[model samples]
Target chain A: MEIKETFGLMARHTDDVIVVCALGMSANEWWQVTGSEDTFYMHGAMGFASSFALGLAVAMPDKQVWIIDGDGSLCMNLGTLLTASGQGPANLKHFVLNNGVYQTVGGVPMTGASRSSYTAIAAGAGVERCYTADSMNALSAVLADIKKPGHCFIDLQVERDDGPILAPPQPFEGPEMKYRFGRAMERRFGIEVFGPEGY
Target chain B: MSNPTVHDQLVAALKRCDVGLAASLPDDWITPTLQRLDREPGIAHIRVAREAEAVAAASGAFFAGARSVAVMGATGLFTCLGELATLNLRHQIPLFMLVSERGSRDDHRIYQEVQGRRIKPVLESLDFPYFRITSTADIEELPHAYEWCRMQKRPVIGFLARKLLKG
Candidate 1:
């Protein structure tokens, strides 16, 4: 099972409330895998997917929220791991594809990056438990262990490199999507998007 | 007796750094601090929809030649984690984070404590340094923290004690 296949299976299980944010290389693979133009937010701004996922999870507790991230990307926002742990959102699942390098930016080797033990970091951050996988079978088995009413952090150790991949051509939808998102969040969280007066 | 209130000390410390943009989402605890920050004409305080959005906006502001910071609660810090690590850490961008302390074991609410204690450890795991402040006495170090961030080209966080904010 390729990484893309893994995403497809996860997508099938996700409902409308589940929000996905893909960053860096994973974003490149994910936009294609899900073919979900709107389902994922290709945060051109790296390291923010987890944070955004947290917001969506808190706002829509009933929905299953997913984050497709890269090791380099996750390392950049490593603080988020701890933050996410503390939030303890049962419906959120964080999948980090660790290629042992910044695969998106020239595939440069990250110093002691892989040896950094993200699983330990996740567990220490209060994730309860975390899983790591390189092959699809392992991934499916670990993902199966992710029970509901808890957060799952999966660190996927993939090949050090993937061939050339292009970002989605369609520019990310503008403020309109934000408005819709805000409305949906407001409905779920019962808080106005921009407060009582609206922004 | 102190010459300035805790709020005044914070404002002075921020002013000393010549901070331009103060971005945040409103919280009852930090409302007074936000209002005080707004009073400084030298600082432009902008309210963002989300805590992470404020961090991103601050990143943009820094690139555009502005020194900026975002105000948020301890829990809001969790929400802004991606930006704190990515834009701020990966790119070596400096965005000051002023977070309100909450969810300690003694706190009145059970709201976000489950995850609140994890904030410090998260910062540690990320290898980012932060300063925890409890009163006006700590104002003198703001410039040093700001300068170090300038030199290192990364984000530095300042956690304000709950009592200080309550006052």
Candidate 2:
């Protein structure tokens, strides 16, 4: 399936889930598909988005959290799968956009992409609900299961689109992004993300 | 204070700061404290495979309106400098880390020498603020340090001195 099509399918499945996007292609494409202020688009931290999403899931046990990760990012921190599995937060869902290359850095081929099985790796890491979808219909078929409880992993094999990238990122700086995300959380969940003095 | 007392005091201070979650990768110096955190009923302790995972996890917990901390050794902290710069620094997320202050005169570990000699200078170059905790009295300041980290909107390192941990 095409990367855009994969994102479209995932976007349609997003209900009230808060998304965390890895830097580069995942963040850019997610912004294109969903102009969401609720999502935390990582501009840095190449491989730790999954860990960040895991933390959020643990903190808000009642809320569902999804991380849109890339293969390069996943390879950078494969231990995250182990950590996620060990913690096993029931509200967390991990999805990897595997295109066999680093889509953001001018399509450089990623290591072990062709031969590696991310689902098998996640399964070995103790994530029991592991799925792989290579086509739009396959992805659509697994949408319902994605929303189900328990720590889950999905490897979406997509064809890298050489087309022009759409959706410019939010213009806000780092601190502004923090406040925006925190405020959105407070507004949505009626929780105090910041103190009374607004630290 | 004895070694166990210091651990008790540190954990109590974390509780006083309202830290509900802790993410950690163990080092010998901080192992006692991590054990204490693991046993604390009110705090959820997450054992991670890498130090950067702990850092990122604690950063994410902040957005969920949760106060959290990351614990690691000095060498582990060195391994996570890139993630610290990109994730915590780039995002202006406040992450409170309790790191074992290794490579001091009392610490004879040769592998830790580079971390001891270079960690502070690197943190200085990155503009990250840190404080050294040396004794039981210093444990009381953790809550204040935690508040300062949030106000600063950056990662703050609280270095637990070898002397204190050895108690």
Every candidate's lDDT: 0.68, 0.88
- Summarize candidate 2's per-residue lDDT along B52-149 as a digit string, tens digits: 99999999999999999999999999999999998888878989999999997889989989899999999999999999999878898889999999
Score residue B134 of candidate 1 by CA lDDT. Answer: 77
- Please, what are the lDDT tens digits per residue for candidate 1 over residues A113-186? 84688888888888966888777788768766764568888888776654433545334443333434445555
Clash counts for all predictions = 2, 0
The 10-residue segment with the lowest total lDDT in model 2 chain A? A161-170
How much is the TM-score of the A chain of model 1? 0.80
For each candidate, report what fraction of the true interface contacts it reproduces.
0.05, 0.85
DockQ per candidate: 0.07, 0.84
A85-197 in candidate 2: lDDT tens per residue? 88888888899988888776667787777777999999999996999998778888778877778888999888875543454666666777788888999998899999999
Per-residue lDDT over B60-140 for candidate 1, one digit per residue giving the tens place of the 0 to 100 score = 444224566778888888876766765566545566778887776555777867656798899889877788787666777
Q: Cα lDDT for residue B150, model 2?
A: 90
User: Model 1 segments beyond 4 Å from truth?
Assistant: A162-199, B1-167
Off by over 4 Å in 2: A162-167, B1-4
